[model samples]
Target chain A: MSQQLAVGIDIGGTNTKFGIVDRRGNILCDGRMLTNKHEDVNCFLDELHQHMSVLIEQVGGSENIKGIGVGAPNGNFYNGNIEYAPNLRWKGVVPLASLLEKKFSLPTVLTNDANAAALGELIYGAARGMKDFIVITLGTGVGSGIVANGQLIYGHDGFAGELGHIIVIPGGRLHPGTGAHGSLEAYASATGVTNTAIEFLSTRPEVPSLMREHSKEEINSKLIYEAAMKGDPLAMEVYEYTGQILGAALANFVMFSSPEAIVLFGGLTQAGDVIMKPVREHMEKNLLPIFRNKVKLLFSELKESDAAILGASALAWEMKD
Target chain B: MSQQLAVGIDIGGTNTKFGIVDRRGNILCDGRMLTNKHEDVNCFLDELHQHMSVLIEQVGGSENIKGIGVGAPNGNFYNGNIEYAPNLRWKGVVPLASLLEKKFSLPTVLTNDANAAALGELIYGAARGMKDFIVITLGTGVGSGIVANGQLIYGHDGFAGELGHIIVIPGGRLHPGTGAHGSLEAYASATGVTNTAIEFLSTRPEVPSLMREHSKEEINSKLIYEAAMKGDPLAMEVYEYTGQILGAALANFVMFSSPEAIVLFGGLTQAGDVIMKPVREHMEKNLLPIFRNKVKLLFSELKESDAAILGASALAWEMKD
Candidate 1:
């Protein structure tokens, strides 16, 4: 086991996951806390500090920790701040990295959750030794991180890779979250799958569907996936539609940066070939001649339970002087 | 003049322009040759060598030349080959850079013309000292070069930034060149401008304009610009629609890479505020709040007659080793 370790923290809307991680991406110690319980940001920081101290002691004190890396909803790598993250309930910008650094007396780095996931892949997952690739998370909302020329692309403002917002179908689906019409998030996210299932039921009322028996309030993505597994035709059609939309968008992304692989992660990938097959077919069909068969579609190799912690710690490791 | 000068060559379908350029971007001597005259690439190269030898002697000799950089239709920077260029008579994968290196005994590098133009902007024109930006050429067809993290995004393949081929409208317009439906190039290119005018005339027969008088052959982007300059309503509407399409696409591009600036080049920019106003309005309207009003929309600063040569030479200078 590597004696050197970094602390990784992933701050979500409801909870925060923290861990002490080795260079090889093992989470030696871990903790979690309710993020929204404390209304004040400083109180949240104090809670975070208290928990970190315990983990630091377990790893033989602060000296064993090289630095801290944080992944949050609106984290800014350049400024080390989280600005106007709607889900965080914090007013304006939060200088989370500075606060952590001041308390721990160690270096700290911050990046958006998707960017952290990308760094995680680069350090210890599928993207090891690869110079160019993209990681897309199809969870509640869609998120992405772009890597090119062996470096994370932190554009002019430290927020370059927002692939979810790219309009895949003009005047098509409307995103309920961001109000951006025709976004990839509107059709490919977990919520998008549930919403698409709902839309299909209403639009095709005359058609028979297993989903129709469950009603809109009861049928979620999990229910839809279960139905599809049971060979429900309407449920299968929903996955196919979602996959086609996602695949078409992925084709556009390939045209933009031409990454070697596009790694899909999160709840939606659980549908497996029900989604991947259509995505592959449409992405290949839409790609230009030069890029037709070159790009590989991959799944996240990192363990789901430990990925966020492992990914964040990788960024911390990079901050070593 | 500096004793060390790089040779820049711009190979087009019609003509081949070559020049000796100093570090300060000044063209010391220049020459041109008809490209299609020779069916064979070697014959074309020999003629080029004959003319270049005269210009090389005018400065100093082969010793004075630092290296040769070429900008061609389908130039591949990795392999230094022009691969399957539809416009060029050269059959599959002509190793032009290697031939130039063998004959001149100098370091030679080649890249796709748009990428060369991006290097030109970075080294000698608008994008100096900038870390992230995009250069878009809106001429016969829409072409782009993306720069992020202070380097051009070449993706996994040598060709990465083919922003023109991105599907914007989904099923809107069919690209004559790539066969992709509803592409930005189909709406923003000069031919697109002409096509849009024809389509508008047919769709809204009641709409009056000077474009209707010129017939299809005579009504070009230039003629449309002149009509818009003279306050023709139909022509103005055509520009508005084109700008709207371009603006929406730019918004999507912004979401993808979050560039500091998107530099517009080529013939369409000459339409000026007539096109720029709607582009700004729609681009801003479509942009997410985080990126709103942040990205500057600028025009290319390199002089048209000398830009291609200068841009190519900039790439040559970068390949000093």
Candidate 2:
């Protein structure tokens, strides 16, 4: 008999990614389709099934496949639904997992993208063999997935580990999404880095920044990282400020759960030491004495392009019969 | 055959309370001794064993007791040691569980006081049968114990769930105990309530109130609660302020772990609606939409005096061998 494989699917606003994966976390076959083109959830799933069915054939047919796992915005493991995920074309609650299972005729499981990312790290990346740790993704917005006692904490509502929405600054920066002040996401995300740079530039008109040459449309976290690498002081400060806020928030997270480590993933972490040094410094500075130096801060070893699909696939491997 | 019983011990700065409790959570006998006078942990353990031995005899004999469970400041469940606990008279690392086992000739388990309290609630109090919940103790200082996926999270270091140390207000109030500024403990504990009242009074000297009749030393949380009950605006404001801070912090907690309920325990909770109303309101106000109404804020049902002892005994009952 052929070795068992699983189908990993990631539902994004623009595109949907699906891959056939082996038990060892290898993506055997990969495929993608434009999500926005499919206005209906059923159309999207039908297209995904067609794409995945071909991938399974390439990897020696459905008999070799085990199950399907999905990761999307606002995915709920408890009900296997994606409820009010603003990014998705699906409106209200969509029974995504059941739809996928009905199409593919396989066991299926679902969870939020951040939880999938954490499981990805736990099964095949930085958190391997770790029983207690947190994976924080600093992307368009901050997202987190907590793993304790070798299990993902779905909480009472399958929406646990929303660390980004937590008010780290308490009435400082106002989050546009949640409308809460001083949230970690408001200051530490890609948009946050951009907001910080714009805010800093607005306050001091005389500061010579490479950012001034570009229109606001041209500015982003990637461009900011390039500017900081070129020794732009303002660009450097953006990363520093972001890291300080992130580090302080990380300290709070450490104190709350006392994880063995915290693994950072996403675009902001690309700044490396610019974001990490201050984060490490402030996290340690803020921790209670006993918790000091005990938590290992790490960067994700998983490749950014493949991480989401791999993470989603981890959920498939995790599904019990 | 005799009924199996467990010995529960709560070690505090002022006193050490011990009790022999049955499997059904009933106290067969109870006793306590002055902890500060002993000066040494060995002397303390010797006295505790001698005292507990008598309680064991009254319940039948040592053979009838299943095990011993000790809850102390800084207790490490993994190594059974109390490391550098500020409140305890014993200095440095004290192997507390081993000491009790050596003298008492019974298998023993150890955990921090807050964790024990959570276990007590899980077994015999408000958290009964709930899998995911958080217990926040607002005493002289704030502490917390987190239960997720039906087990107390003894993170990699056996010191998970220290919610009090989580920085709620960045660079805000300073915690004298942890030296971390803007920690939850610095703003929501009994000490914090007194300090807020003092700070409020210092800011508004013209406001005529009953608090003005007492010296700075006489104004405490209990008095503040009484004044709030009588509808003193300034005193009422203190509970509102404390609850606001606590509620905002609770919102963040609900986001992080998404616990089914947050059980507030200890002296500060005595203020009842004066605190609960604001805590619930602010918590909901700060929380994201999905978590807002889903998480319940509850007052612990455990009798304050017996909570510590009951919490410790629950740990013994949880032991596997």
Candidate 3:
């Protein structure tokens, strides 16, 4: 019980997951609650504090807790604010770290969720020993955290590592969230996969697919994955197309900072080889000879939410006095 | 007279430019020679030494010189070797750095030409106070050096920041040098401009322009610039096309590292607003709202070869004994 612990909160669009994580990445206790339900950020904080108090009390109290770390969409490390996140109900800049510090009476740190995941990778996952690597989260939308020389490239602004928004297919597909055309997110996210499946079914109507059984709304990445597992050609082709775009984007990223490995995380990675095969192939095909076959394409070893929680908590440990 | 100096050498595909640079970026003396005339690197070195010795003598000899820095295509900073450069006739790995060290008895450093140009920008040009920026050399081919957190992103391997080779268009245009299709180099380079003009003239034969005055063999970037200046619609459209592609690629690069600015260098940049206007427009159009209208697009202030030489020389000042 003497071991110091840090509180980590990952604020997602649908759910907010919080946990007490030790330095070794062990989660003593964790909980989740509805995020979008609280239209006001203050109400969200009140509910978050109420639930988190119980977890802190279980772990012996605030004295044992080092501090708090948060992972949120559009969270800025330099400013500690959540600035106009598309997924969040909060309209503008919410000084999340300051709000959390006032509530918990402890120091707090904040960064974008993808950056938090990258820090988690650096602390306890696949990139544990590696100095240069990129962690890409392929969930609701494509998110990436680039680690170069063992540091996350926050760019001149805190908004660096937006790999998903990069236009892979110039004027190809429109991203509903960003309103940008041919962004990697337009074709590689779960939403992107769903869109691709619908497009495929509509365009290639003669080519029968198990995906046809479900309505467009019911058709999702899981159904596509299941169809692929059952050897559905259309479903498999969907992944091939997605992977091709992703692989090409990855090649561009590799050339940018020449990382040691690219760790893919989130729901999309579950497709596994159905997706990984084309990603590896297209990435290698696009790369120059010097860069070819050098970067390791990998999947996240940690559980999705746990990785985010641990990653956020890792940020707390580095908080300065 | 007592000011310390460094020898800066820029090895281009056609010419090798060397100079004696003082600590404050002044080139006291400089000389150029044909790069591929000597098949043997040793003979090249001998000629280089013979020419450089006169400059060194003029500048008061080795006593005032700190070291030497060489910038060449495919020059590796980690291994201090030129590893299989496509442009250079010296095939395979050429240990030019060690050979220079042996020849001059001075500590030597080596990095790719673009990286050298980046360093030059950081030390003496527009990016003097900037910690994050990118330097793009739009010469025979598109070359780039990315600076992040006030340091060049050398990556895990020494060979990072090869932005020119990153594919902007999939299977769009074939790069004769790398056999890769639709590389940024395929459309944004000086050679790429020549190719685009040739392509435009061939495809749009119905269109009339000053470019028709020159034969296919005579048409080059200089001629295209000259024609575009005179309000030739076809030639102006060529620059517009080039900038559109370059701007789109810049947008992708911006998302990757989120640099403060992108400094354009080399011959093609002399087209000025004729090329820059389109690049700025397309880069903005392709970027996410968070990234749009933020990055400063500027021209390199340093003279082309001088910037590379100064940048390479700057590396010498940092070489540890």
Candidates' DockQ values?
A: 0.73, 0.78, 0.80
TM-score of 2: 0.94
Report lDDT per candidate. 0.84, 0.85, 0.90
lDDT string, candidate 2, A64-122, tens digits: 87788888877898989987764456677899888888898888889987898888898
**Each model's backbone clash number:** 0, 0, 0
Top model by DockQ, which number?
Answer: 3
Mark the regions of model 3 whose C-alpha exceeds 4 Å error after superposition: A1-3, A206-208, B1-3
Put down candidate 1 lDDT per residue, A1-321, tens digits, no spaces: 343899999886556899998876778989999878888988998998898898898989888888888988768899999876645678578899998889889899999878888888877888888999999977766778899999998889987777877888877788765678888878887778998899889897776678788868997989999988888888898998998889988988998888999988877888788889999999998877777889999888887547778888888877747
lDDT of 3 at A48: 94
- By summed lDDT, the worst window of 10 consecutive residues in model 3 chain A runs over A170-179
Candidate 3 TM-score, true structure as reference: 0.96
DockQ of 2: 0.78
- Native-referenced DockQ of model 1: 0.73
Query: What's candidate 2's i-RMS value?
Result: 1.0
lDDT of 2 at A254: 89
